[model samples]
Target: MSSTLLAKPQMRGLLGKRLRFHIFGAFAVSLGVVALYKFGVAEPRKRAYADYYKNFDATKEYEAMKQAGVFHCVRPRE
Candidate 1:
């Protein structure tokens, strides 16, 4: 009816007023989400990985794989 409300100057002016707040709101939301992910998932996963490697015996695993004949050297294509 009224040429799509978006074409109205009043609407544009309203959007301009709230545009900065919207941008700031989006930024705040994204930053909060990232912080939550880092604390809830990434940090815990990193800590778990560090703990796993800390007590891990790489030599034992390599020897076990060697004994099982599971280790193989791939030849390069010449």
Candidate 2:
């Protein structure tokens, strides 16, 4: 391959504009997706968990704590 082909162009215009357009479009789409998930989907799921825990029984609570690796009792002193 010729060194001229690998070298940076002495003149640049259209290529830079096209690259900038694609980059900005991608950033806008990503921001829209994150905003939708935070405002639209997560609120109801959070409420359901809150309601479930509010009515949870001791046996169920103890099971959940065990699954999460949390224990109610402290270890005895050595």
Candidate 3:
């Protein structure tokens, strides 16, 4: 009981310092995770999709689909 009474003030100060450290550490970690995912995952996917479409023959596929009557000319837009 006497030890608890004497430790209250010290505990309060330690709590404040630890709380600040925890908050800042959490923020830094979250930012790092987001940056790593963007660079490692999202950017690579975008580049792969661009590469795939770079050599895709859009006009030839469109002509084939049109010849096969796979499309409906519902009021062509200008």
Candidate 4:
């Protein structure tokens, strides 16, 4: 028989041999991404928002808006 005709089928050693390891690696990578986002992005954003609202005075803000004519509205129909 020709050498080409005697070829064996290709094995899926890359993925089929160790699927569990691949799945675990993927899960670990996803968990790391989530952790990075929580710490790097979400935590800093949350801290910034908390700091902004830390000394927030609602009545002072409302007074500023009132001076800006924000409360000038037409009367409702009788």
Q: Estimate each model's TM-score.
A: 0.70, 0.53, 0.62, 0.66
The most accurate candidate by TM-score is 1
Per-residue accuracy of model 1 over 1-78 as CA lDDT, tens digit each: 677666535644787779889999999999999999999999999999999999999989877777777857733235
> After aligning candidate 4 to the native by TM-score, how far in Å is the CA of 15 from where it should be?
5.6
* Candidate 2 segments exceeding 4 Å error: 1-11, 60-78
Q: lDDT: which is higher, 2 or 3? A: 3
Query: Best to worst by TM-score, what's the order?
Result: 1, 4, 3, 2
Model 4 lowest lDDT segment of ten: 69-78
| Residue lDDT tens for model 4, 13-56 | 75675788988999999999999999999999999999999999
**Across residues 5-50, which tens digit of lDDT does each residue of candidate 3 receive?**
7443565479889989999999999999999999999999999999
**Could you give me the TM-score of model 1 versus the true structure?**
0.70
Where does candidate 1 stray beyond 4 Å? 1-12, 73-78
Query: Compared with the true structure, what per-residue lDDT tens digits does model 2 show for residues 23-75?
Result: 99999999999989987889878998999888879887767777676864743
Off by over 4 Å in 4: 1-16, 74-78
Candidate 3 has which clashing residue pairs, if any? none
Q: 41 in model 2: Cα distance from truth in Å?
A: 2.0
Q: What lDDT is reached at residue 44 by model 4?
A: 100
What lDDT, from 0 to 1, does candidate 4 have? Answer: 0.85
* C-alpha RMSD values across all candidates: 9.0, 10.0, 5.3, 6.1
Candidate 3 vs 4: which has more TM-score: 4
Model 3, residue 44: distance off in Å is 1.1
